[model samples]
Target chain A: MSALLQVRGLSRHYGQRIGCEDVSFDLHPGELLCVVGESGSGKSTLLSTVAAQLAPSAGTVRYRQRDGEWLELGTLSEADRRRLAREEWGFVTQNPRDGLRLNVSAGANVAERLMALGMRNYSQLRGIARSWLERVEIDAARIDDAPTSFSGGMQQRLQIARTLVTQPRLVFMDEPTAGLDVSVQARILDLLRGLVNELGLAAVMVTHDLAVARLLAARTIVMQGGRVVETGLTDQILDDPQHPYTQLLVSSVLTT
Target chain B: MTPSYNFAFLDEDTKRMLRRALLKAVAIPGYQVPFGSREMPLPYGWGTGGIQVTAALLGRDDILKVIDQGADDTTNAVNIRRFFARVAGVETTEHTVDASLIQTRHRIPETPLREDQILVFQVPEPEPLRTLEPREAETRTLHALADYGLMHVKLYEDIAQYGHIATSYDYPVLVDDRFLTSPSPIPKFDNPKLDRSPALMLFGAGREKRLYAIPPYTKVESLAFDDHPFEIQRWEHRCELCGSAESYLDEVIVDDRGSRMFVCSDTDFCGDRRAEAQA
Candidate 1:
């Protein structure tokens, strides 16, 4: 019933240049919010600022802890912030190579978060990693193989598995399906939707693809020139747009 | 002392600066303290770090012992001992127990050290995460966060490939339950000897300009998994000359016919054992 994440008037600036301005949202448990826009429209800046990867120029981002305490992201020490990032939160990058440790095996990649949280038992970690790999449709037989040896799709799936293995409550994804072939992108999108729904995860995803927003996000926010143009339910925004930017976005996509 | 050189081959001011850094290193117990490293007469890789530490700690009455790869007669060992003898004019000994200060490379003495004794190690690299994460800034952040998951990944890869941790010398260790440190290329066989030891252990890296210390009776754990635990190297044969089976052994080629014999890596320990047998 309560909001899991609260953002109030979040703004980030690159000196005099505006990155994102006056963005406010509430993400509830088991909810997915997608921010869709053209490139350089502040979608990524909003995500990174909210995720505490970049400093906010104005406003506060608060997250509810597992213990039911509200933590102000701006006030947390560097150590506590890093701990929260590794233990409670997960970030899935656009490139799987950036998200996954290339030198380590797939199993180690999945088990890295657990190990970071002090899971000392090797067999238990390996077992969990193997099961997660299978759940993500990666062959369990390839657990010991380097992620570089995997195809792009498989690598992305492995990255998702690595992020979700720790069972993080909220995940931040930045153009996760970007740069993949269309078929591969469709498969990854489907896999992501299933996993997000099954795990009841609250996620904030940044994507330029409106179709991706429609497929994954329950609530959608459309941005233009670092400002929110329109926001509503995914279906309503796609069907009946109120803002000029929203109408243009709906018309620009190739609707079947 | 030699007329041309100051005591211990270093100026009084340099020794004082080194002493300050050594104090801070000892106080933090495994945290690397940065110091101004001066060029020594010896080459950089050839125990320059250990020599500086020795020069700083050497006293008028302190007996010095230097060893390279557990041998007292190796060129590195002999030259370092002679270097100290000529500069500081201090007493130098080959016996481990008789010496008050021990400067070593790549090995720990087989004989257990006493509380009064101090062990100095020549370190080529000070940072344990250097090979895994190339960025010094990122590695420092990892250490500050105590996030050592990258280390486990390395061990995990070793297990996946060779079925166990293949790292023999220079294995990683968690010092004082805080800093992940490099144990200066000592075989994993000696890793256990580092835990709760009576002697003080100091590590110096001249090339890296860092120094760290482990006071007596501190916890030193070699990184390993629960199922894939840490294990040491073992030999099937005993030392050929001393007939001691417990010490670390080195394989020696005996003849042109491909016959080989195992000998104790610690020459002093092997000699003492042979002397005891003769007695």
Candidate 2:
């Protein structure tokens, strides 16, 4: 079957620095693919390029529309990209601070995506925000509290809430559980897994944590030196890594 | 001769209009009052709102501090301070504790403000419901009726999908626990400063032509759900320059290759610390 998202010869560079070179991938609907890489592996650059946050220097990222049309992400105008981002794509950043508008109330933050998509009913928006807060294990009483007052785990959950509120078909998460405690990280990973399964949302998650990838992604891609080193089923890759880099990563996880 | 710009770059008529709007803002605390705004020399979306407020409030006795994203030396802040110095002929200080009036574009000063000091915020859009209900007329009716059903629904949907309320900046709030207000674009980190602040807080939206104020000691609550409350971003790292843990920080790109150093965004706050160390 044709993929929901297709990238062909995708490349991005920051002047002399190679962000990503000759990178390509395909993501199917309801599938969670985790792109694992180290600090300078261009993992973030790849995600940002796909999310239209960063313009690619070369190649194409095409998204299959509901109407069976294929639209090149880079070719779309700014307004068009914004509309797509609001209507079809949800992006979650590594830092909850960058992902959300921290000054707004949690309810406002959740409601904002809907508002951006032109949903105009205050009572309904509040109800939705309250419901989501409960789902994220946040007490309903603090819906009006600013995200600034939230703990790191809660903030990441809120970022997830903000993106998911719109019910976009595609969700891109960059290090969703990076800074949270181990327990919080597990809970968030579990939450994400349950939600993705229930909503049938296609997701591309970028993380350095191999365990996190195994828990949430069906498929895994290992990247090193701004290039994909391996790609396969999460279980297969974890059990029998092909590339030396993936082998090292798997070995390191086992030792620790 | 092309008429040279006024001392502060804003024309006299604009200053007069701002003066009138400011009086009304002061009179009706927490009320967003509208005005017939004039074109300012500065861009409409920039610090024109704060500049107008400063122009109206400037007096020989007052000292001013302007900060953007909490930094005093940011280009925008520097320009604003220079504007006041040229037009108002008032003293400008980089010490947040010493300033009588502060015109801030984004982040609030890190120093705990005194009752005598007043904070003026430059707002891009004053209406909290603008993003929800694009029609100003409809939103006004909703506000008047205290109807906020739409906001709740959006939050609920977020729960259904992501399991949390997602928002980062320009967070909404309940002013006086009644009207929903936008606390400008200050990071959620600074929203706590709005609650019962000793200093009076004013918001001006030049493009939207609105002015609002929160009187000293008034209650300002950020909007949230019972289960999921609002939050601000916290870093395990402290400010590298001032060694201050409490201040808002800007992540500065130190190298062309993306190396970063987090420093206090509030220049006046940093300067005061440096001065204290020297002392």
Candidate 3:
């Protein structure tokens, strides 16, 4: 398959501070890539810059539109960018509240993206939302409940459901399993794995957890100090210590 | 410094500026053109936008009418009419059909407007997406892009929760299939009249500092899901005074025993019907 996204020399800077610099990557259809780094690393900054949520100070992020045309994402008009974000891509923030509409019901959260894509059938919207909730391992009975009523794991699952309901070509997920309990995290990870494989979705996930990258991603990127330190197969990087940062990241994980 | 303002209370330069914006509004059909909205003698919410629009359009030959909640004698409407009379020295009429310019607060007149007339709406909040999205900057970007997903989701959520869109007043509409605009606080019943209108319709939001217009014969659609089409409110009771079943009615508390009566909200229309019945 042709490359879904192409990022070349992408960088984002906040004044004199470096957010992400000299980052280049290509994502194919149905491929899951993970960006792993420490707290101060530019993992999320790189993701946000590619997602167009944050403005980049330098370099270019090229996106292949659904119409077989590749365009520089940096130069797109605000309207075109918003439309592309709604139709072609999705962003899952780390905090579920940032990704989900807190006041609206769970069903509406999943249905909002469909509405943005111009789905006007009320019955169909509700039906798809209900199925997605079930797919996310959420009971359909709680569909009408607001996000406030849901637990942290349930809210995060709902956010995932909402993002994937659009069937976007690419999804940007920031630490999807970062805040959940171990058991809930395992369940969510399994559900996400099933959806990603079944839907043939291309995803760029950011997490500091090596285990998360091992379970979900095929390719992994290691970053330190706002730059890519290592890139390889997930198993290869996690099994062998290549770079000093990658060694520290792999060795720190306690294999019980 | 007590200085006399020009004709209709605005200076020629400001009027010219307003007229230029008004022309652009007509040209674009539903797009909100940003203008330097002037503060009127009235406060922000009391139809200041409508007053400014009327002041810009008023001339010696134009007959003006003002109504609040469809009543010419309502306190706010009466004040506006008195102010226009004192300042512009123009003739005022309560009859909807006779007036060349009608500035309304909430309800559109029952009388079908003529092609020669203009309807100026007193808009408190002009941006339809403001209720769904709180951020002004975000809403402006959405407007610029004609992205109305927030509104659709809000209405669709109403259906998912309540089985119908619960919005009765200030129902959102798409003007010329381009901009989603607020029809002020007018009930959804008046929304149908906005489509293919013979009269030129101008909307002014003084506090929000925006002005918009809908030219004659432009389409105005109420935002709704496909399975759940847009609908207006209906009542089982006919007008108690005019005995008309078709007119929009307002409920009035008649007694201390919790009694109420449904009467025509458009006072002039009700009065004319009553006069005709008596004759």
Candidate 4:
């Protein structure tokens, strides 16, 4: 199948400092890709640039609409961009507080996206939000409860539900399981994997952990210091370790 | 009066900036334009917005009028009037008809404003969705989308709970069918005057750093559901002092008992009516 998103020569710079440079990729439908890099590796910059959250300094990110036409992402109007983020694309932030609207109830956060999509009937919106909460393993009754009241793991799952309830065509997840307990991380990863497969979601997930990449992504790209250093099948990259940074990463995790 | 300050106590550059913002505000009709709010001689909520707007718009020949809750004798009104009389050396008036510029808090004049007059309101809050949605970022987006379902649900729930929409004052209105604006704290009675009036209406919230305008002859709708229409407050008693039944009445306690007497909230209106009665 043709790619759903085409990004070429993408770069973002912060004055004298480099954020990311020359990042190019094509993402297809029903594919899950993981971007693995450590702190300040430009993996996040690349993700945000491609997602059109942070504008690219020197390249293009084109999204192919469902009608089979390519539209330049950078040129979309503010209204159209918001609409796309609400209806077609979902972004899951690393910190749950950043991803979820903390002031509103867990139900409203889920229903808000539905509301942004033009659903007006209160009961129907609440019903769909409740079902999605249940699907995310949050108690249906806790739908009215604020995500702040949830445990860290539950908050992450609620964030997942808020993003996925829109049934977005693509999702950009920034460390979906970064700061949770090992037990919590496992459960969230399991929930995310199940949903992505069942819905045939296209996702670009950024994570520092090789194990997370192996667990979620069919293909993986390794970033180092504002550049993608390696790209290949997840198993081949994780098991063989081609780049010096990838070898060091695998060895450090193996040693620890 | 000693004129120690610049014209209207504002620098020419500041006035020019304010004038530009005012023009943008008039063009947009209800969208709030952010401006650099200056610290004035008065406190924040005590008509700073109205002061800034009046200062920017005041010309040497403009007759200024200031009123608080429809009373020119009130301390806030008296001080604001004294402020302009001293700094700008402009003539001040108590009569609503003669004044070219009226800076008000919580009331519009009983006299219908003319095409030459301008009304500036001191606004504590500029966003109508603010009470419903606390976040400024979210409210901006909501205004952009023209999606006010949150407000509808709140009002609808009020109807479901109380058998009526219980809000009495500072009622919300959709301005120019585009921006849902707060018509300041003016009671809903003054809302009708805002609709298709010949005079230009400007609103300023200094503490909030925002200003907006409703040009002459703009469509302003007080928000309401189809089944439950918008309604203004009315009192049973006529003005005991002026014997005018049409004016907005303020209830005054009598004899420290349950008995009460209603008086006209508009001091000028009541005074005019009493003079005409005596004649």
Candidate 5:
């Protein structure tokens, strides 16, 4: 399968603090790849750099456009990056608050990505928002409620709804279920698994949790101190970890 | 008294136009009413919208409070408060409970506001459909017809593409189930405050030439679908400074080595907490 996204030698740093360095990966069409690491291991940095939220210190992020051409994300101008971010790529932050505009209704949040993609009919927007909300397992009657009123897990689901509303080819999520309760996290992971399989969309998720990775990702890449230490099938890495960090992570989850 | 600028630093004509717009905003609850906006002494992207609204609403008896990111001592807030004190000759207070009218950019005060208070928002763009549609002429038609089909398609697309929606700021909302509006740029954490708020809420976009409002007791809904309704951000992390788990917080970089602290965004709230501790 042709890769939908290609990253080469991606590196980023804030002065002496190394955000991420010498990272490289490829994502195939309809693939779910989870980038797992510790808090300072540069997982979020890699995701942000690919999403074009932060400029990489060095390296290239190549996105396969609909026209069968690859566009270097770093080389694109700000306007182009914004356009791509809005129309072609979706990014969900670690914190649901960071990923959604809370003051707007649930419908508006879902509609915003579509609006960015140039959808304009209100009746159509409302209908689609309602359906998407139902698909995410939220009540349609609460469509107008502020995101602030929803629980942590619900907000993450809503954040997912807001990003996916645009129908972008690729989506990036950073620690999406980090702060949610376990039960809520399970529901979100289940929803994400169902959606990814149903839509056949390509996704890159950054997380510190191995269980989350196992739940939603088919492929897993482990990073330690800003370098990729392990890469393989999610089950393989989880069942028989290769890297010391990966083993530690798997053991830690099991112990707790 | 020596004079430095006109009444409230805004020319009389601008104030009059804002006053007219304010009246219209009050007349139609939760509707984004357009007005002839003028450039202010401050930059367009700053608090020109809230400054204009404050200029229009200022009276001898009115007590004004200006806050940015929910703090009165913030430089922008101080400058705005000074502007009013110098130009309009109105008293300025840091207390949310004391102020008759509060002009805010990016945040709502922590205290529960009374019905007598008025909250004016500084909006960069007033149209909720602008991001979805981009063209003003087309979005106006969408609002006029109460059409929101484009918004739904966007959400559906999110499910199809990312397995979720991917927006974080300036989220759109449905007002009174009739008009779709932007609730300024307050974090999703602040969205619940707009629902059935006792204090009247008004929005002004100086650059966009629009004004809007939500009357007390009016139904304001953030747009969402039934299955994936809207949600706000909550943190397991509490405010380090005020020890407040409920209040909105500002993430602060405390040291050069990257140590971080979370402080209450509302200065009065923090100060009150400090005072209580001392007592």
Candidate 6:
């Protein structure tokens, strides 16, 4: 099968300091890849560069359009890039507050992307928003409630529903479950697993938790000091790690 | 005429600069064009923008009319009219049909504007997305991209909360199907008059230092959903004085006991109707 996205020697530098160096990967349709690293290991930087949020200092990121055309992400105009971000792609921030419009109702938050793409019928938008809310385990009755009134886990779920309402081809998640409780994290992971499978979405997730990689990601890229130290199947990387950094990450997981 | 100040209280150079911005604003229908806003003798909120626009456009032969909330004799309207008469020495009239230039605040005239007339709107806040998105830089980018999802979200919130789009005034509109323009706080009842109108409509915000326009025959569509379509406010009580059911009405309290009566908000329209009936 052909890859949906291709990153070739992608490098981002903060002047004299390296953010992420020589990160290359091929993400296929329906593939879920996790970038596992410690703090300041360039996982977030790589994610941002790949998502076109931050301009890479060097290298090319190519995305295959729905019409079977390969588009050079760097070459796209700002308008074009913003259009792509709104219409075809989605970003789920680490904080639900960052992703969801807190002042607006839950329905409006979920329906915003559709409205952006010219969906004018309010009832139709509300209906779609309702279904997505149910899909994300948010009660349809609370559609009019503000995200500010929601609990942390509910807010995260609402963020997921908002991002997925447009049925985006690719989604970038930055530590989606980082701050959630263990029980809440497991539920969110389960919901994400079902969604990724049902929607056939390609996702690049950045997380420091190895258990989360095992739970949701099919493939894992281990990073250390702004470099990919190991890349393999999530099970293989956790079972028999090749790199010393990968070995430490796998060993660090406390199995109670 | 006294020649101490230049024509219309602004110097020739400043008028030329304002004319340039006004021309650009008219050229790009509904797109807000930034301009150098001069401090008028009046305070910022008291129709400074509309006064500047009228001053720039007023000629010696023009008849000017100023209205505040559709009333021609209010403090704001009277002061502005007096200001123009003193500075420009132009003929001023209260009749909407007789005026060549009409500077308005908060309402459009009940009488239909003709091809020869020009309508200048005094805008307090020019950006339609200002309330939704606060950052000026981000709002500019959104306008450039025609990304008005925030506007729809606002409408959606209104519907979800109030069971309808509850925004009564300053409703956002897509002008000429391109720029999302604010119709300068005019009631949504007057929104239909903006579409395909024969007269040119210019908007100016003195505090904001921005100007925008809707050329004759331009499309001005209020933002709405197909299900929850754009709607205007309706009045159950007709004008008690003029007995006109079609005009925008203001409720006037008769006594301290809260006895009130509905009257035509447009004083000129009401007076004209009364005169016609008497005739």
TM-score against native, each model? 0.98, 0.53, 0.96, 0.77, 0.53, 0.98
Report every candidate's CA lDDT: 0.93, 0.83, 0.91, 0.88, 0.82, 0.94
Candidate closest to the true structure, highest DockQ: 6
How would the docking of model 6 be graded?
high
RMSD of 3: 1.9
The sequence of per-residue lDDT tens digits that candidate 6 reaches over residues B87-166 is 88899999999999999999999999999999999999999999878899999999998898889999999999999999
Residues A1-256, candidate 6: write the lDDT tens digits.
Answer: 9999999999999999999999999999999999999999999999999999999999999999899899999999999899889988999999999998888899999999999999999999999999999999989999999899999999999999999889999999999999999999999999999999999999999999999999999999999889999998999999999998899888988989
Q: Which stretches of candidate 4 lie above 4 Å from their native place?
A: A12-22, A57-59, A74-80, A117-124, A235-256, B1-21, B33-40, B55-64, B84-100, B109-116, B125-174, B187-193, B206-210, B221-279
lDDT of 4 by residue, A107-206 (tens): 7777767755656565576679889999999999887676789999999999999899989999999998999999989989999999999999999999
lDDT of 3 by residue, B73-185 (tens): 98999999988888888999999989999999999999899899999999999988876788989888888887888888789778778889998999999999998889999
| Each model's backbone clash number | 1, 69, 0, 0, 55, 0
Instruction: Summarize candidate 5's per-residue lDDT along A47-153 as a digit string, tens digits.
Output: 88888889999999998998989898888976677678777788888888878877567877887777655554555777888899998999988887778999888
- Model 6 interface RMSD, one decimal: 0.6
What's the interface RMS deviation of candidate 4? 5.1
> In model 1, which runs have C-alpha deviations exceeding 4 angstroms?
none
DockQ for all candidate structures vs. native: 0.69, 0.03, 0.84, 0.09, 0.04, 0.88
lDDT of 5 at B264: 89
Each candidate's fnat = 0.73, 0.03, 0.86, 0.03, 0.05, 0.89
Ranking by DockQ: 6, 3, 1, 4, 5, 2
User: B1-279 in candidate 4: lDDT tens per residue?
Assistant: 565789899999999999999999999999999999999999999988889999999999999999999999999999999999998999999999999999999999988999999999999999887866789998998888887756654554455346677776788888998888899999998888889989999999999999999999999998875556888888888999988878899988888668989999999999998999899
lDDT at residue B95 of model 3 (Cα atoms): 95
Report the C-alpha lDDT of model 2 over B41-63, residue by residue, as the tens digit. 78988877777777777776999
The Cα error of candidate 6 at residue B113, in Å, is 0.7
Candidate 3 stretches greater than 4 Å from native: B1-5
* Residue pair clashes in candidate 4: none
* A1-256 per-residue lDDT for model 1 (tens digits): 9999999999999999999999999999889999999999999999999999999999999999889899999998889988888888999999999999898889999998888888877889889999999998999999999999999999999999999999999999999999999999998999999999999999999999999998998999999888898988999999999999889888999867
**Model 2 chain A poorest 10 in a row by lDDT:** A115-124
Q: What are the per-residue Cα lDDT tens digits for candidate 1 across B117-151?
A: 99999999999989889999899899888889888
